[model samples]
Target: MNGASLATGQRSLGDPSVTFPLWPPQLRGCPETSTAEIAYPVEVDYAYEDVDTALFAQAPGPDLARWAPLLPPLHAPTLGEGGTPLLELDGLPGVYLKDESRNPTWSHKDRLNRVTVSAAVGAGAPGVVVASSGNHGASAAAYAARAGLPAIVLASAEAPPAVQSFVRAYGAKVLTMPAEDRWPLMRRIKVLTMPAEDRWPLMRRIVDRFGYHPVSNLTVTHTGHPFGAEGYKTIAYELFAQLGRVPAAVFTPTGYAEMLYGVWKGFAELRRLGVAETAPPMYACEPAVGAPHARALATGTPAAIVELGPTGAYGIACTVGGHRGVRAVRDSGGEAVPVTDDELRAAQELLARQGLWQELSGAAGLAGYRRLGREFDGPVVCVGTSSGFKDLETGRERVRLLEDVDVDVSLDDLLRATDA
Candidate 1:
């Protein structure tokens, strides 16, 4: 079957009857609810068929559009976002690294933006708006620019300087505000309401008033963008093609778990298409502080929100966990693994020694695996989602210059100074 063989639509994760078209700007929340504050999870649906293996086996093209058959319609511009290398560490026999830092914006968010911006284009929106602590804003701004649309980013004042610079570099209008104030501004450009007590009301305003497409989660529970996660499916396809089959385990760094869910769905689709016999167990790795997914799994709930503690791995320190992540972990017999900042830092250092400078949060998968300390039956893959350059702590080291070098110093004296 070709790319056009499938029809894409949206279905509410909480209520099946509450459905809408994914292309046009649809209801941000379930229409059945009287409370505008109630946000529901929504997902994209597509018709399935047995297609030839060649569809995935083909050498991956530069952009995410290469997997058009499985993704939403391509209504936006391309920036060579996909086809990142699957690297192996010499010391780790069964472990492989899905290095996603190679994406256009140097993070996995590029994959998400490629599809979400396309959604904006499909709906004929003038521009895009997003609320991100870092990588998401940078990717959205870059993709929106590529799609010939103005971009607006609502970022926290606490956002890393590098990420703020990246967003501005893409020419997106960057508004630094209190985290609570971001969602309200997302609704009406002029109406910057006092920080609302909840997130859902402002989410509705963002769609109903601003006519701007949202690339990230708006729900109290993170349903994520129906089209955005489709971009991450390419990572699964690439892994299968590169490994010749699905690995035994796939470890992913989880915040809202959008990428984790997407990767699991991609592998499930592969199995459905008879491309592989079974999908791997997915591990959702998170910072030790506020691991909502872990709490949700333990409590037998679809989603949960937990109290957060301080963590240097800010990118993945999400307080709220999504149903998508819980489902992926449950269905695959996977577990939520929470790692300390120290563990993640060590993992990042390990990657750096291997010539892969990954963000501390992005090294979570390896940290999880190290915590697991079990022998896998076959190959295991850990996703490294971004570059170390994006981390707030990443910077040049300070070194002491031994006394200012004297012009009269001899070569032997210089050698002695160096030894000293």
Candidate 2:
């Protein structure tokens, strides 16, 4: 009946204060309790009603302004990652394409970095660093610049030049390093930069203390600010709002599985708040070369930390599992499907027919959907996570709009001859 209660759209059982950590602890495996108490720097007051609205809104949960102040003003990018058109594929039962190439950074990674940079700003770091093969680096750099924060992206020299160019364009410092050096450096950065206690106060005063902000490495799954994943929740929220119901399944291309975790968590929150009747089963589509999620799923484990193999779909290429990946698969009752490069290329062609352009890894969801579409009932949405331009260093073949031809004579000569 009160104003705050009306906005929340729920009655509070009681007002309670609780301690929260700087970051949500990663879900290792199936636990006795469905939710884990996360640790943030400060204590927050929570009510049943607060969780209710956060669950159902057409956005991800958590307040980014509170959690990540170093970010630029949060606004919807016009390119449209959040409200993607869910189109039904012809002859594919209940299959839908959730195209993400339209995003500002031309990838779904934009959603994650937007949240991650906010956290970096909140943490009072001088700059953020990341180890990325491509899309993640581009997005991280883009958001870092927007927040007026410095960024350093470590990438392999062998990576596509176009990807490298994107990082530079955003004015992020690019560090070309070997794969062995990337993770070790990232871990060191997190330890040195993050405050041991009182993370909220440090984060809150980021802008005020320093006119120019800097954030540390963004590659850490656990270290990333909570608000980063919140951006991805918007995907699910919009899907639910637009469709007027939850889909039967959602298939995503998994690297660290952050995107998958956000969507799954969003739906779970909705279901918990009585907004959604059920949660969709989440399916992860990874390259066959390094299918960590698939291996973990096969063993019924939360994640399989293994060495990564070589692959062209470098964006979703990672050896170990993040906390989100484990939780996403287990909580959704979903599985990971390994897809080959050939299969992804074919999916890309399929999307091209529908006028949706996507990168190779982005096509993995479509590949999985093609294989699993028969089993799923009702609606099935597969996310295309990036644009082809990110990997153009190999050089995509040019498409000719016209063929070479010659005219026998000029217009005046033809007219004179015809008249005569």
Candidate 3:
């Protein structure tokens, strides 16, 4: 079992004393979430004292199973996730880019789905369901298919066509609805009015009726699968080994802040095991269009729901924030960074020049770092979450133009035509 028994129990982030056994798989959110304004996420606790420091020694590779004991019971089949590269860029001094687009589904969500799907398998659940605009849904679909189970993706109709096709290609049931309606339907709270009745049924009563385990959030706020965030801890472990020490700062793209919290937890675990003395401060990067985490942090609230604005970077443009993010920031003495679409596009372009084609939202770490506009004491790390191919622009029908730009014209005219 690779010492999997070291995982002691699960506890609520709001009230750590509210705990439960990890065995039978706590796939559901905090059942004690009583208030509408304050839905808390639960987290996994481990016997870190029992863990041997020698196990921290790792080589470069794309397999998270090696850290199986540090992670949740990974009953789901592997799709070659984790162990992404930590690269240095020219413009940002002492900052390394931890590119996660290398995963099976070309997104960091692969790490999360690996554990979430396994929870489904461990629990003997029928299948899995999730609500995502892009990467999360695709990763869930791929993992579910690998586990020989069906998946239902409650995606936004506004989601890029390529992402829509990517999810369906995995044989998942794709139900595209208005972005706002997806969450309420998952909670089975209330359905919203839409243009068509067809999209309505796609989001309703998935868990209660179909008996499918929800791999995404169903709480009033964004308390996703407890095991999912644990998957992201692998990133921190990989970073420590790659850099030869813990960094002074780490920037992460944040929608629900699961990844932000997970990264912090991994480093915290290292401190607990005495492998490292300190955990780096995590910076949660969210689109200014709707930075709920940043808003909550400013107001001294655990989490908040913000009035959202439109932006091209949809992946990290979340409305509801989670308490885990708050805990991570507060515990680590970190702060939230809100990024604008202009900054996201600029960051994407910058990384692309560095031969890293991160998606608009994927470049959020750089955007946040740039927004901060300063250098750190020690090495800094900025996480790149997804590929540029996952961008909405990649789905548009402009690729056909590349077949022939009519190079018959003069060199000057050709350069002008191609916008070179």
- How do all models score by TM-score? 0.88, 0.72, 0.91
For model 3, what is the alpha-carbon lDDT of residue 54? 73
**lDDT value for model 1:** 0.81
Instruction: State how far residue 256 of model 3 sits from its true place (Å).
Output: 0.4
Please provide, for model 3 over 1-420, each residue's C-alpha lDDT reduced to its tens digit, 9 standing for 90 to 100: 245636778888777778888965554467775376777888888877678777788675776787887888888889999889899988677988999999999999999999899989988889898887699999999999999999988776577878878888999877654546565554553223332223324434777787888888876677888888999998989999999999999999999988999999999999988899999999999999889988888999889998889888888877789888988988998889999999999999999998999999999999999999877999999999999888888856442234466657788866666542
Clashes of each: 0, 19, 0
Candidate 1 residue runs with Cα over 4 Å from true position: 15-19, 25-40, 50-52, 178-206, 396-399, 402-420
Report the lDDT tens digits of candidate 2 across residue range 1-420.
112211111111111133233333211111221233321111112244544354343342223332122222343222223455667777675778877776778888776776666556655557766656588778888887787778766566566777877788989766553334444654455222221122322322333444323222122122233345556776787678767789989999887677887788778767877888899999988888878777777776544666666677877876655556666787789988888888888998888887887888889898987766457667888988988787543565554442333376678765555441
Top candidate, metric lDDT: 3
The whole-model C-alpha lDDT of candidate 3 against the native structure comes to 0.84
The top-ranked prediction according to TM-score is 3
RMSD of each: 4.0, 9.8, 4.1
Which tens-of-lDDT digit does each residue in 167-279 have in candidate 1?
88888877654456465554456222222223334445555687778777676667667677778888999999989889999999999898998999899999988889999
What RMSD value applies to candidate 1? 4.0
Candidate with more favorable, higher TM-score: 1 or 2: 1
RMSD after Cα superposition, model 2? 9.8
